[model samples]
Target chain A: MEESPTIYEQIRTSGYSRRDFLKFCAWVTAFMGIEASGIGNVVRAMETKHRLPVVWFHFQECTCCSESFLRSSHPIVAEIILDKLSLAYTETLQAAAGYQAEEVLYNTMKKYKGEYLMLVEGSVPTDNDGVYCCIAGKTSLDIVKEAAEGAKAIISWGSCASNGCIQAANPNPTGATPIHKIIKNKPIINVPGCPPIGEVMAGVIVYLLTFDRIPELDGMGRPKAFYSRRIHDTCYRRPNYDAGLFVESFDDESARKGYCLYKMGCKGPVTYNACAVTKWNNGVSYPIKSGHPCIGCSEENFWDNGPFYQHLASFPGFGIETTADDIGLAVGAVTVAGIAAHAVRANIKKRKLINADIEESKKEGGE
Target chain B: MEDQKIKRVYVWEIPVRIYHWLNALVVVTLAVTGYLIGNPLAIQSSAEAYLGYWFGTVRFIHFVAAFIFFFNFLFRIYWGFAGNKYADWKNFIPYTKKYIRECYDVLKLDILHIKVKPFISVGHNALAGLTYFLTFLAFLFQSITGFGMYSAMSDSFFPKLFAWVVPFLGGDFAVRQWHHLMMWFFIIFAVVHVYIVFYHDYVERRGVLSSMAGGWKFIEKDKPT
Candidate 1:
């Protein structure tokens, strides 16, 4: 391995000041929700640790994961994160071609065996000799296995690499499979989303660089810090839900006012993610904030769950089965009873009026 | 059977009655509208295909009624502690020895059809009181969990307060399953409650249903508490 220049030297060479470096650490500390005291640790790690070696692989995906990753707003996220990270081999970003790229991957695998990070960006195909996808006449499964064999840990970039995405959706002809399903020995972190927020991707990488290990993950193998709360939990229009103010139509006044989208086929109630809180574009707006419903891209198999436009029946209401329809059925039955009561009361009133008329006629006849 | 009118005092106030009826109305509305949204029962009218006005109107009514029912829950909880002897917490909870014995007597009278006279009180009967008490507990749980689920979207204060439930129920998927199952329980409870109320009022000639509307029921002169 080459004796690389220290991060400070690289930062100076890269045109970033010492003050800028400290500010970046502070920003990352806050974003990770760590205390100010922890800022020193992150700064120390970044300054001391050698640049992390990375090998990124792509298969059976739309490349949206890489698209989102490049959009990270943090200055170092683009500079120190992607640039100084010693990204030796990546099919999407690497410029080297043919034998040169393959040579770099093989050298990195041999040089930093069981030490470098392996980031897989897409799902692997398994059927028919894995012939559905190939690079340099080799199947994607073989390529992933060969690269993953020398990696310390792996990060599945998105839903495609984590849970097979739409490729594994209905009849999965190519036998598409997530990275975790194929590799069990390595510690795999699944950052699931159609395309996860750019900052979250940066945060995960930062956490790994700072902590030198994978962050705590939920049962689904997603980092707990980001996926802890549902998008619904952090949504701004929640008051409208409690108030029963819902947007009935896309063009309705309620929709314009940004009322709750629960009635309008929003899966936000059942979907869990940090979209509403962390948001996109520097925390400016999320799907719900942008007048779109959450399709629950973070959760597993969101595509197979159902149509995105149709509302779920009973969302976890009050942690109970208080679905909008269940509540409606209960009300409909009561309304019918109310109507019956109204009919009975009206009949009795009519009968009394007729009796009074008969009595008046009898009195007039007698007179 | 003719029963003589007695001095049976009104235990439920106008607010209490309003709360009760309003809750009933809203709960029913929520169940029906909620069902249609989930399963989407087959449409009967051709206009429903192009317009969907009826479904939309039902949903609007359902949400409005839910707001009222939620308030009703709040009011009832308050009344359970603040109201008169009958509406008070002591009446609902059968802790006293005499009330426990009365429960047995009431059950015996019901089973044997002994033609025994009715007792007068502002509160519910022992069995009825127990069921209502359970319903209140269910309502409280539902409110907290519902709010937990609700705040999940808006990041409201309620979800923050009850955020611990997310883990206890095993993530969003389990929470969703629990929420779905509990709705059916409420629907079943509502169905059985209506059936028994109507059966007593029409078949058994007990006039129980009328008491909800008129605030009183006639009892035989021979009855005593």
Candidate 2:
């Protein structure tokens, strides 16, 4: 295999000072929740290890994952991260296009077979031979299967790739399927979110490059360092939730006071991500911090979970679409009414039976 | 002569009566607190957020009641095997042909109101026993969903065992929705159960309500049923 420039050498050639390179390492290491001692190791690894070749692919997605990755909280993301990786091919960022782009993809696969990382954005559509999404006349199913055949590990970049995002919501017409579902043999990491926090995307890539192995994963195959805890668990507004102080609506007085957004259909309690702690846009604020409920963008089938402003989800079955409370109340009321009617009829029947028994006893005594 | 002849039968033992009452209490506790945890009341106090821990207290009550309910259910399972014939396992499970017939007979008499003769059951009637068996399954459902959500907040091994249920059901939202709906099941069950007990009490004069409290039910000595 051809040797690639180390991250430090590439960064220096790209006009980044050595101090800037080390600073990026420390920032990413801290974001990964690694101890202070781990920062030095990260720097040493990046300075010596050759650039890891990556073949990033896009399928049925909104390109927001790429947007989030390139515009990570740090300024060096586009410069170092994109430039540092010996990126063989990426539809979004690669300078090549058309047939030339296709050639790069094949050459990288052939040259770095079993060595390069396969980073996927969005989901693959398999219905009708994967015609829903086609890149250069080849269906996503064909491309993904071909690309994933020899990769060491697959990093699914967002809810689109990890859990099929909006495309795989209820009544999915395209049969959009996530990466892990299709590529069963390879090690997969699911970084699920509408567009997972920018820093988190960077952290996942950094963790893999530094250690040359996948990070610890949760039951959902997400990196545990960032996806283990629910936003509610570490939320600054948790005290308000515990106190039963909640925003009833968008313009309510409770909302003005910055009480918990749970009553307004905030799904922080159910969604697992680093948004509450890591914040977004370089620690500026997250959805809850900005007066909007979480909407559970990070969880699977978040779009189908329910309305964005309702606390309860719309139960899926039974042709009638309604909240649990609506159905529960209706069923409960009907049952009570049935009981009332049954009690009235039962009482009448009991009285009639009792009078008949009394008459029979009197006749027996007279006889 | 038939109306004058009567027999007092020992139906429920002390253990069965205690289990019944305890289960009733636990169900009420769990349903109320579980509902509140899902749709908490907006009690905005003027005091600081830390000063009011009402929601936390509601959740704590739910957890405590849930544990009690789970253990109470387990105890009832044990009693189904060990208790007297009236409380035996055979009655709860409608396996035999006779038990299935009893269900039909009771349904005709109580619900259809077409059967003139009253169906007599020394213990729970087959239909009611069958309903209770279904309720037990609902009980198990609530426990599974309850523990699954609890696993996220707790590090204990007991709750951890149910962690698999979270992803299995598609995560926290689905589990909470299901658990909340089951609370309504218990509510409806309680309403119907109480009405049936009263209706039978008036018709039979067999002390159906008192039987639960005193372990005795009055039966007719002449009738074979």
Candidate 3:
């Protein structure tokens, strides 16, 4: 079997000039937040290294990750990245079906053992012996275990795979669990978003390919280069949040004027993601920019964190309509009422004791 | 009947009195600002976003109060080690059999409303000491979670030290929830603490409130030690 050409040769054959290929390398390097000095190194790595074989697996997911990846703004992302990388098996993108797809998966595993990358989308269902999500007559759990054993590193593509998005929300019927929970031994990198930005997905892949190692990850196994700061920090309307100018309602004047959506339960402050910086659909706009508050889809248990349109409040149903002042005032009133009642009881008890003392004194006098 | 004389016993040292008032101020500031941070007032300002900065000011006040609260609590801990017996760290632990007995006696007298003679201690009773110890732990938790959340925004090394606490406690949202809940704990503690102090002042006639102010607690000279 003739060895497949390097990504550079593939790019050259595809009629992209040497300049276009170096520009692609520099663009990916910039996305990875590598210093300008490392651009040549990135170029060298891309020119020399073979495209790593990626086995993309889908479980209980919305297929939004693949959709996002397909929509990458870069011209070569779909042409070069999707086509050039040896994507041996993917349910959504693969041309082969059934036995042929299974053959590719097994062949890739056997040939590139301890070398291929595993990209898991969505979460694996554990209930009823993983009956909820099955592929090719095998439970996703079984497939994940089999594939993860041979992969170099695993990338949990979305919140479903990273922190068990909506599938693993409250009363998770399927017992859907994130990849990291089941595959404990593997070096897992979590790129968590509802459907993480395409540029970020490419950035993660490029960083891995260039450095031959995973990017510096934060405590949650997310790449620090992208997920280190919160969306709130980089948001354009942050000054409004700092200034206490909030959108009171979805259709209010503040919303029209692009004030902060914090009062409307924007989870930007608590959610860590690169959405505000990278944006979505080719740096056009994110949820916050499009007159909607962040649902915090990237954070853990976001679906259970309460309603999307209401800020974090003690009471579930009384989030947007009721202010903390209302609760504080009510508590204050109750505290005062209790104090008053206690005071009245204490006063009556004191008076009774005083009366008893006088009666005892009078009885002594009579004696 | 013989006349009763009052002996003024210096219980709270200057450092303890200072710590008490400072802690009270810091706690109040922290609770108010912390509540505001969680549930910011919808201030409709006609001024530009940069000019208004009202929420930022609230956050700044909260952070400042948090630092003071943390350091004041630390100072109190140090005073517990270095100050007199009344301010001793040993009093807070309640490990000794006598301390445990005093705790039970105080609990009976206060909560159970039993007519048991109050366990007379020059400083905080065992129950109060234990409560204060728990409050200290709560203070530590709030600091960890608060700083942990702040670490994301701040570039300073002090706040960064607690960055791991957010991930350890699950995430930023959970950390905020726990931090907010702890604020209620402080508020409740303040209410109960104030009531108990006044009640003790009335019953024991030890000038509980004034002692906190002046560092002198008056005791009946003829009373048993």
Candidate 4:
């Protein structure tokens, strides 16, 4: 087959007008947090560069990442970006099956060796000879290592691929491990939501396509452009949080008024994601906007952190539903009971000593 | 009884007494407010969302107490260096052979409940001194983790100094867990500390409780200086 056309040619052939293309470029540039001056650079890159080949892999995940990516609200994002990308092989999206799919993946890896981008969407299990998750009779660990060796960079999509998600929660039976931990040599960028925002995913791809390099990453290797700030920092109900107003429960008046969900165990304060600033479903509303607390899905081991409905106080794995008050009250009761018991013992010991002293004095008086 | 002579030894200085009471107050404030901050009460208020700052007030009290606790701890450290021999930094550490011996003696008398003659000290008993040392270390841990969590929400330079601690310890969730756990440590320490002080006052007859308030401890004149 002839070499694939540049993104500009693909967009033009797809019936997108020049104005529409430039508008998309500007929109992506802004989404990438690039200044207005950088719009020309983004457009130029798109016009000149051929789409990069991506081998999307799945190990042990729910395919929510791909679902979220396909559901990108932007028309061009879903239509142009996903379609235009040289997605050589993806288990979920690829039409080929069995040997044909494996052949495509091998071909992409060989043809674009050290050039293709590897997008991993799930965690690789390391226990029991990696029998928990496998593809084509090859364990995920073997696949990830083999793919990562030749890829230019790896994009760990979603929490499963980033931090093991619920699969890596306490007592992880399969011993599921994230991609970054498995592949240490490659420059891995983690997009760590349960299902990262579709726009954010698109923005990361656009950034890589435009800049020809991975975006700036935070300490946890997430794109700083989107994951730099906590959800609470940009939450609309922050004023209510500062004023100590919170939703007491799901059906309460405060919930109707859309009060802050901090009291309802919102993990927004600790969770770093673009959900608050870039609301999901085409900026319609996010979890907090819908009067539900943030479950902190993007955070590492968030499932093991605590329950979704309770605050963070009852942490340290006492129980799923136990709150801080329960622990405190129990400890307080124990302390009181222990102290009372000690006090009673002390009183008995003192009385014994006094009686012994009285008996000794009486004997001395008789003598 | 009339012939018995008592010598009033000034062990805790005014600074030590002040630090003790202030530290106690700050610990109580931090425990209650910290618990409330961790697990806030569901206050059903008829007031507007903007008008109710109750939780914020609880957080404010916690932060303020944390600050006071931190600085008071710092002042105590300073006084430990500058204060008299009894309040010296050296007293807190069990470096010398004497301190170790005293520790054994006190353990035998108090915890072990042995009938051995108590070896009296002018200042803190070696065991008490060691316990205080451990509590001080716990205080430092709480300060670092507490300020680390606060750094995210605070704009202050001081709290920001501890900002690195959160990422260094993994994340805010872990830091909060540790900070909460340390609060319980303080509560347990307070209970044991107060009980031990009273127990020593009864058994040793050393005015251990009053000594913290008045800076003086009554020692038998015949006892070795």
Scored by TM-score, the top model is 2
Task: Using DockQ, give the best candidate's number.
Answer: 2
On lDDT, the stronger of 1 and 2 is 2
Of the candidates numbered 1 and 3, which has the greater DockQ value? 3
- Chain A only TM-scores, each candidate in turn: 0.84, 0.94, 0.91, 0.90
Q: With candidate 1 superimposed using the best TM-score fit, by how many Å does residue A112's alpha carbon deviate from the native?
A: 0.7
TM-score of each: 0.61, 0.95, 0.93, 0.89
lDDT by residue (A1-367, candidate 3, tens digit) is 2277887888788899998888888887887888999998888877877878989999999989989988988877776557788788889888999899999999999999999999999999999999999998999999999999999999999999999999998689999999999999989999999898888899998888888898999999999988998899999999999999999988888888999999898999999999898899888999999999898888998887776777764444565445344565567678757666755654554555447757866996698
| Candidate lDDT values, in order | 0.72, 0.88, 0.85, 0.84
Give each prediction's DockQ, rounded to 2 decimals.
Answer: 0.10, 0.75, 0.51, 0.42
The residue-level lDDT of candidate 3 at B84 comes to 97
Better-scoring candidate (lDDT), 1 or 4: 4
Quote the lDDT for B214 in model 4.
85
Candidate 4 segments whose C-alpha is farther than 4 A from its true place: A1-4, A313-320, A344-367, B1-4, B94-101, B155-158, B167-170
Clashing pairs in 4: none
Model 1 misplacement above 4 A:
A313-367, B1-178, B185-225
- For candidate 1, the docking band is incorrect
CA lDDT of A168 in candidate 1? 88
Rank order (by DockQ, best first): 2, 3, 4, 1
Error of 3 at B171 (Å): 1.4
For model 2, how does the per-residue alpha-carbon lDDT over B1-225 read when each residue is reduced to its tens digit? 344577889999998999899989988888888778778899886778989889988888889988988988899889999999988878778899998988998888888676645447888899988998999899899899999999989988999999899889887888888888888889889988898898888777789999999999999877658
Please give the lDDT score at residue A66 for candidate 2.
Answer: 83
Cα lDDT tens digits, model 1, A91-121, are 8788998999999989999999999999988
Query: How far out, in Å, is residue A113 in model 1?
Result: 0.7
